[model samples]
Target: MDVELFKDGKRLDGRDVEDLRKPLKLEVGVLQKANGSAYMEWGKNKILAGVFGPKEAIPKHLANPERGVIRCIYTMSTFAGLEDHGRMGPNRRSIEISKVMREALENVVMLEKFPSTIIEVYVIVLQSEGGTRVSSLTAAAAALMDAGIPMKEPIAAVAAGKAGGKVILDLNKDEDNYGEADVPMAFTKSGDIVLFQMDGKLSKEELETAIDYGWKGTEKLFELQRKAFEEEYSEPLDKKLRMVE
Candidate 1:
């Protein structure tokens, strides 16, 4: 690895082991045509999520008479990476991520309210620097809320891992590639873990530590999710006045 993942007390990005990248930005209602949409930028990662549905389920057979079905599609642009050569269409990795993303949001959605329908979430990674799954999930949750889907609570996700034998919160590209382990987790606002995936090895103690860090990171993420909604609702007076003018 060209970058020193951990040195003295900092990683390649000069953040302490547990510190997430700053200036995580989120915006909602970016797409006019979609039922709802959201955009997120975390460090170098940029992703967009759009939600459509509670509409009729295509193919007919996939619809559940008792509850709505959630479908999630995650895609990475060919130029999303530092290189410009990713293949188009759904690959195995994206397919698997889409499945997990669907499950994470499915639990919180009040699907029973819209029987025989489908709620589709499309996540597009415009740029990537690691932890795209978590970023995508975060944006997906926001998009669902923006779509006015009834939900128990918003979901938040984060990645925590072992680096230099220490459990750290939020892994950037270098840390993820060079670190000893990476654990990505998602939770509801009430702290229910809806998704968890681990890559690499970790001892029992390290695993526990990583989970704790993951929860803490998700708590922060949940706050950001709420902040996005607040900003969405709180239109500035200047903008309103300009509209009036």
Candidate 2:
């Protein structure tokens, strides 16, 4: 952990403190059977998200007579972080992540449309380097849109932290591991902060600095989500030009 993470305001990977990783890719409607699906590759992280139901809420009790429910399950393949401490099945970390992810998604969905139903979202991490939650959130939002779910708008995810004694944006695995503080967040187009979580330690100023970076990064991330949807829904230049989404 003593290794220097930054040199002259640039990370070891040669990225500026506020820059997002390059070669990010996203695909929507990747699964045929699922109502909606998306695949996202961000940095070294590979994540897949699928949406199901809106049919009926299982067990009845989890359903609300007045509205629908959102059930999210976030899991990592055993090999995803196996080299670092991945578990065989759902553990405390996975359970907690699922809860928080569900809350973030619920903020943008119009649950009232499917009364007494459940919209199930599953996000699986096939690989990891860091920032998996944010990546998962980005993919899940696209999958929901692919499923034609009613939504207020799309949201994006970004993370920032204090690493190498400097506040940096979009942390990688190494920085997240060795950094003094980490904050992952989700944001809406209206600038509403839907998801926020902090790990490690930071002073008030450091926290604010990290969050500011996160907000800035989210602006671009949200566009990536939209781009995925547009590509998937866009018709070939032959028949109908483009579908209004």
Local distance difference test, each candidate: 0.89, 0.88
lDDT of 1 at 61: 98
Give a tens-digit lDDT track for model 2, residues 1-245: 38799887689899999999867899888886788889999988999999997888888888898889999999998889738654657889889989988999889999988899999999999998899999999999989998889999998898888899989998999999888888999998889999999998989998888888998998888888888868876864222243467
Off by over 4 Å in 1: 1-3, 236-245
lDDT of 1: 0.89
* Backbone clashes in model 2: 0
Best model number under lDDT: 1
Instruction: Please give, for residues 176-214, the per-residue lDDT of candidate 1 as tens digits.
Output: 888889999998988899999999999999999888888
For all predicted structures, in order, the TM-scores are 0.93, 0.92
Q: Give all candidate RMSDs, comma-separated.
A: 3.5, 4.2
| Stretches of candidate 2 exceeding 4 Å from the true structure | 82-88, 235-245
For model 2, where is the 10-residue window of minimal lDDT? Answer: 235-244
